[model samples]
Target chain A: MQLRQLSLRPFRNFARIDLEFAEGGAVIVGANGRGKSNILEAICYQSIGKSIRGARDHEAVPHGEGHFDIRGDWQQGQRRHPCRVFYGADDGKRVFLDEAPLPRVSDLVSHFQTVYFAPQDVALVLQFSAQRRRLLDIVLSQADAVYLKALQTYQRLLTQRNHFLRSLGHRGVDPTEREVWDAQLAKPGALLRHHRLLGLVEIMPDFARQYDVFSTGQETAGLLYADEVIESNPDEIPTRDQLEATFRQQLRDGFEKERHAGHTLNGPHRDGFVFTIDGEAADAFGSQGQQKSVLLSWKMAELRLLERRKGQQPLLLLDDVFSELDPIRSAHLIEMVEDFDQVILTAPRQPQESLGDRYARIDLE
Target chain B: MGPEPLEDLVVAFTRLPGIGRKTAQRLALYVLKSPPQEAESLAAAVRAARENIGHCTRCFHLTERGQELCHICRDPRRDTGMICVVEEASDALALERSELMRGTYHVLGGALSPLDGVGPEDLRIAELVERVREEGIREVILAHNASAEGEATAEYIHQRLDGMTQVSRLARGLPAGSDLDLADRTTLAHALQGRVQF
Candidate 1:
């Protein structure tokens, strides 16, 4: 899916803005802190019903306003569809497709699988494994509705289980009451790990290829599904039996500790994905430039994965990511957008000398 | 007569679950004027339970002694062949109030949902299957909610128990998508009685 036009009303720094794409791509160029990122964020919000920058609904609203709305005309299949997202004063958020209310955010993912890349994404390669895991999850969640559903269920159970644990010390409450939560936590917990592993498998080759292109064949990166629950064995991936046995054992051993901690501890929340280069952790050893290359490669791969799975090019949102890369890397990144139907790039200023007449420019002054 | 102590009492009360600042103030005012003996008794009751009560070893129920099974699981008269699987221990109490099913239960801890990254490996499903295999359960009754995650969970358990034992799910009487904990006792009991083979 590709976004044709985006209209924002009282969203972030943009009080009223309407911009159209050039069928291929459009670049929003302005100085730093001149609301370029805000425009890109609004477009991403319109597509996913959440900010790529992790802004709360209230924060997405104009500084002095209590509400914000984003309207987008997107092309999917052979037709152009209108999608809208609105947030209210009461912190309520709603999404509509063609004027009909969407049942869940996953519904929107199928039609508007926009990929967003930002400077912070460098953390995907240089920071904790959770960052890379999140990168994998965002891509996989958009590609598969089942994975999204599983993720939602796992989060709900995690909250409920934590709430129950906190209440264990309350008077008249039975400690054994937690057994029920333990049993309930396992099902979703296992599904999450399974899908995550599957996600890694699907993205590994893409990650490797993108890393090679960005790194100029200097490094070979691999995605590793890291977890304490997976026993040290000859198996590359844990079997269903091994997973179940480990889950049961962890539940048995962590019961008392969970009760004391007032939260469930042994599950996917504790799981991470390791990024390795030549059998060494890349995050700890990779230089800043190398980290940026790794993240860009992964994100570009994400765009390809979405395109391949959905049979359409996804909208690309580059939020001030160009300024962080060298001219050559920036040119390579811009070239990748040629395959996408629509691309929105946020930069400090138009690269007039490099881009020339290739991209339509919108000055976010 | 000073408001200082009264304010502290209100804050403490508000810290309790489900109690708001207004309710906390009202409760604190009532307690402040109550007899000293009654106040002392309340404190003693709280401490007495904390020092004594513990989880049952066999059934994992909260009890004074952790030696034997919980009352429900220990009762020989209850049906051992039928197990009502649930996500929380409070659900067992909710089920018991109706007195509809005499069968015992096996809590699965939680349902299958992967969004927050929870998977089958995080819960006690293997123990449940083990219980079924070891005890030779006649039927495994799944009482998970009807939400997407809940349905997926029930389906996963059903697949796990394929050819191992007869598995069933609570009927759709409880509504198309509703949590069991929120269902009324009558509706919960009806759903339990009308369970269909998976």
Candidate 2:
């Protein structure tokens, strides 16, 4: 996909602005708190149908402003299209794709594919399990819609199951109904676990290969998924039926514990992955430098995997993450990004040394 | 996007179900270009209908004037022993348009959805139970949408009225004009489960 222009009205601190980027992508340069990231955020919001910063519409709209509107002209292959997003206090949020109203915001999510390497993503290695799950979810959701749909269904089923369990203490509900819900949840939950494992399997090799080369072959890296649900073997990728059976068994086994806990005690929601460096858990002792190399390798692998799966290169948004990188890694990052269709990088200071004319400068004032 | 009056009309139209801003604008402009008398008649009709119409005492469908019951509830020809429960008045109207169902109706305000914070109390389940007990309705057909919440609502209603009345849900299968190949797996599965002998 190609983003030709971004128009923002009363969004965040930028009262109004329209930005057009070169095909090679642009560099947004400004001091801190000058709404530089806001430009990239507006683009990302249009792309993903939500704030990448996880902000609510009311919180994102400018103070005292009744509304905010963002519009974009984009091209996917040879097709040129326009999208508009409008949010107001009275009317609420609305989205249009190619002048046609989108039934749901989710309709636009599949249309706009972007790989965001925000500064915070670098800390994913050291962050909580929720953060790591989010990273995996974003990649997988963009790669395939089925995965996203299954993930959403699993989440809803989890909530409904929890609600049913909570009602058990008060109501004389049939145990059959609880079993039915458990059976329903197991399929999607198992599918999610399966897909996430597949996603990691696809990205791990590239991560390992990249890390070894990028770190000058000093340490070995592996991305291992820990199956908290049923404690299934990490190496085996179970078929949907197998996963469903396993999930059901776990649900049955944990029924007593879950009844006491007032929530589900086992499922993909509790499952998380860990990074390994030289046969040791990265979460506990990996140095910052090791974390950065792993993060870099993982992101690069994600970019390649997305391109391979989607059959189109996704736009890369680096939000000031390129700062403070050593010369070799910076050069490597620049080289890797040049392969993307478009790359938008935001930084407090302009990139120096060998950035060349490939990146257009958008000096935010 | 338009002049203040036009925008206001558009916004008002958009408040209606399934009407987006663009469609609302088109409808507003159509009204504007239409004959002045026609527009007045439209507004007057809407106002008069809203003023006179209230919910039916039993079914909660639309009623006119100071009538105590809707036409359907007042009619002696319709079967009062069985009530077709639907999610909305529009659904009840659709059933009436089909001319297939001879029974009266019950309209739940909406389906049960915990995610949306709609519970059993938020719906017309209590009214439905009262009607079933007082009217001695024999069967309750759950003619609701085939969504998760809709199914849950039907199940809850079933549980509430268990042994008091017979409960049946609307049949699920391929649509009237769709091909068998076009039917989804769930639909086919349902059709097979509910299949009848030739």
Candidate 2 chain A minimal-lDDT segment of 10 residues: A227-236
Q: Could you report the Cα RMSD, in angstroms, for every candidate shown?
A: 10.9, 6.9
Least well predicted 10-residue stretch by lDDT in candidate 1 chain B: B112-121
RMSD of 1: 10.9
Tens-place lDDT digits, model 1, residues A1-365: 66778898878888898988777677788888778877778777766668776667788777778899999888776798898988898648888999898766556765678888886557643586556666666777788766676677778777867766665565333323344456566776776777666556666687788787777557787766653322223346666556656776797798779878978788877776677776566788777777777777778778877888878788888877766887777777776566667777777766643654546888876
Give Cα-based local distance difference scores for all models: 0.73, 0.80
Candidate 2 chain B weakest lDDT stretch, 10 residues? B112-121
Cα deviation at A136, candidate 2, in Å, is: 1.6
Cα lDDT of model 1 by residue, B16-126, tens digit: 999987889889888878999988898899898888776555444455755466777888899988888877667777777889978887666666544454556666778
For candidate 1, give the docking quality class from DockQ: incorrect
Interface RMSD of each: 11.7, 4.2
Each candidate structure's count of clashing pairs: 33, 0
- The candidate that achieves the highest lDDT relative to the unseen native structure: 2
